[model samples]
Target: MLKVQEIRELIKLVDQSSISEFVYEIDDAKIKLKKNTTVTTVEAKPAVQQVVVEEVAKPKAVEVQAVKQETKVEAVKEEVKKDETIDTSDLHKVTSPMVGTFYQAPSPDSDPYVQVGSKVSNETIVCIVEAMKLFNEIEAEVNGEIVEILVKDGQLVEYGQPLFLVKPE
Candidate 1:
């Protein structure tokens, strides 16, 4: 909806113009501004879907309502097939316990708990999973030699996401 100040400015512009009537339509809403010798009439209808702001400061904010529809892309699927870089077969996977950001080191200044050739035993802290400001030390459930770090530091990981690949000792 336009402000009264903006509506007044519109009335002034219309009064000075040769055009007698001005009609504007967006989505399902419509605005009709009419000028006569005696009086001026402004008619506007409410918008349809989710509100969207189109222009700024002419009215400051123009609210528009629209329903969004998502379209599937075949190109994204093809790109995923091309980016197949890892071979997860013949290795034990260390997956995430919860949805959070993964961190290799206990702190930013410290060295990573595990690397490509790092050896680990059951109960050994291999990484930290930070969720909601709490840092959790993730343990190596099985004794193994680290073969791969599947997730990068500061990457958001989902529950059951593979974080590392280990060759059992």
Candidate 2:
């Protein structure tokens, strides 16, 4: 059975490469990845375990479901709405560097590192992304004020997914 970290690594490799499809089988576990014009799907079946990640180009109401035993995980990458009244042209986007769980604070009892209206510099640690038990500190990378947070405190974030919007200083 492949570990979660291994699965994530595979996803990254597939997304970066030109291959449209990939498959791997080891013992009772079988994994398949497929990429298309509008969506990418990853399916893993390991005995009673299964994991699936799906991303669609269109912006519709997102629905996620996870099951026990024969599990299925669905992650939908929502498109940022461009027709909103707010002018985002001058805003800088903070994106996730890898696929992981986004944590706004260091711990459950701690306050978030930054919030909307918080001033930050390039070195500011805005959040932590936990991938395979490793907590990676994510920097603001730009001097600015946090305008909005694009994800929830414990939400799963995808690679290159926008995590926040910053109004540059």
lDDT of each: 0.81, 0.86
- Backbone clashes, candidate 1: 1
Worst 10-residue lDDT window for candidate 2 reads 69-78
State each candidate's clash count. 1, 0
Give per-model TM-scores. Answer: 0.50, 0.52
Per-residue alpha-carbon lDDT of model 2 for 1-169, expressed as tens digits? Answer: 7898999899889889999989888887778888665655555563575779798676444332223312322211122344444677999999999999999999999999999999999999999999999999999999999999999999999999999999999
- Report the error of model 2 at residue 71, Å: 33
Candidate 2, RMSD to the unseen true structure: 14.2
Candidate number with greatest TM-score: 2
Q: Which residues of candidate 2, in runs, are more than 4 Å off?
A: 1-85
Which stretches in model 1 have alpha-carbon errors above 4 Å?
A: 1-87
